[model samples]
Every structure is written in structure tokens, then in C-alpha cells.
Target: MVEKDGIVRVGLDAGMNALVRPAMYDAWHDIVNLQRIDAPADGQFDVVGPICESSDLFGKRRRLPRDTAPGDVMLLADTGAYGHAMASRYNLRELPPEDVIDGPVA
Candidate 1:
């Protein structure tokens, strides 16, 4: 996960990671409040997307700050395994672009 311009970004690889099953199986992640809490605690969250769909989500029981909002950005950790790769062009939705961070992985 990486943050730039107050926006946090996460990566995923479809070939190796399981996306849909995680949510279906009731999995979740933690959303650390880096700005407010000097030491944030681990909590559960219902990780989801703004898009309209029943399966559009990253996690079910994600841990996040109690004050999370729509404008607040959240980086779904360890998503570099399935985030981008599994995205579909559903409803003519465009796929998210990728960038090389710190000069690409070896």
C-alpha cells in the first residue's frame, strides 16, 4: 500500500489471490487511522466499494477507525495479490491503471 496526495492505493494480483471468496467467507482487513490516532488500535471493518453491487468489496470485517468517512481513503493491505487483476469491465467500467512504485519489483 502507498499514499500520495492524500489518496491511498492498493494493488492486487488475480492469478494468485482470492478476491470474491474472501468476502464470501467473511474475511476482513484493518484500516489504520494514521492522521488522528498516534497509535491506532486494531478493529474490524466492512470493507466495500462505492459501486453498486453485492460483491464489490475488499473485505467484510475490516478493522478501521470508528470515524471513517466516504472522503477518507483506505488502503486494503496485501491486496497486491488480487485487487487489480480481478477487476472486470462490467457495465462498461474501465479497469484501473497501474504504476511502477519505487521503480518496479525485481
Candidate 2:
């Protein structure tokens, strides 16, 4: 959901149902474009989820790759500790499917 205003609207498959930290306390999550790690930061972005509420955001004014756009897989850092554990059924959005990475840490 990249907008013309230079704000990338990133919608996650899951929203408040899978992570409430952001909407609850204005938590800040680091976002990175793994495919464009070397790209420069062109402007700010609003990394959000698919939730209906406006508070269902991951990061505000986040600095990401200048070429960042829709369909690009961005990594939300530091969510392993309490991401899925804090999920709920709010907004009737289903929780995101879980995955287990069985390899060396990148």
C-alpha cells in the first residue's frame, strides 16, 4: 500500500489480533526492507496493519528504503518476544500463521 505522498502503508495479514503493543502504548517497531538493505532512506512511512481502527499501526514516520513499495517483504524487528503471544481476535481478524525457521540466524 505505498502511497503517492511517500508514505508506505504496510498492511499486515494480522493486526491488533496479532500484536497490540503498538496501539496500546505507542510502541515503536523497527522496519527494514531485507531486499533493499543497501538502499537509502528517502522519506517517512506509516507501517500499519489491516485492522479497521486507526490505532492499529506498527510504526509512524518510519524511515525505510527509498524504493520501498507494496509487495516488498519488510521485517518487523523485536517481535519474537511478545508478538504472537499477545494476539487477540479483535476486529475479527485471524491471527497470522506461525512459522518455524530451522536454520542459522542471519
Candidate 3:
């Protein structure tokens, strides 16, 4: 994680290998920190990935929960089929099996 010029850049563990929409179609996915769900947004961040390429960005200037730190469980909503189809084993990354949930969990 790095902050400069009032812009915070957050690097996640996953990248284009796991989620390619943002890198491919410039898509938008709502990023939320489950651990800090009830907490108000702390600030905006440029969520990026571990990849070395510039297109590995996840989101730009996204508002996230305050004090969001490493190991925090974050979710990118609506990945759907596109994300799965575009997934790859780039840089020896593992493709996690899909866990399809058709509806809300009780």
C-alpha cells in the first residue's frame, strides 16, 4: 500500500488472473470490506492488484472503510461469468474453483 498526493493505492492479492473485467472492459465492481461493513468510509483508494502491468487496477478512487488494512476480507460484486471466463494461470497463479450461489444465504 502506498499513498501519495492524497491518492491511496491499495494492492490486493488477486489480479487479472482472478478478475479481468476491470482490466479488460474497464468495468465497475463495487468494492466493500466485510470486516468494516458497519464502519463509515474512511477514504478513497486506487485498488490495484499484484500484477506488474499497469492494467491490473481493480478500481480507482474507491471509497472504503476507515483503517482498512492487510488481511481484510474485501468483495468485488457481480463478477459473474465474464470474470470466470477471463481467468487464467498467469504467473503461476491458482484459479480458485467457482462457488456459485444462486440466492442469498440463510
Off by over 4 Å in 2: 2-8, 100-106
Could you tell me how far off, in angstroms, the CA of residue 12 lies in candidate 1 after the best superposition? 16
lDDT of each: 0.46, 0.75, 0.86
> Weakest 10 consecutive residues, lDDT, candidate 2?
4-13
2 or 3: which has the higher TM-score? 3
Clashing pairs in 3: none
**Per-residue lDDT of model 1, residues 1-106, tens digit only:** 3344654433222211234444455445444444445534444454545453656556544455545544553444444545566646655555555543454556
> Candidates' TM-scores?
0.50, 0.77, 0.87
Ranking under lDDT, best-scoring first? 3, 2, 1
lDDT of 3 by residue, 1-41 (tens): 78879888878888888998898899999998878999899
Q: What is candidate 2's TM-score against the reference?
A: 0.77
TM-score of model 3 vs. true structure = 0.87
Instruction: Sort by TM-score, best first.
Output: 3, 2, 1
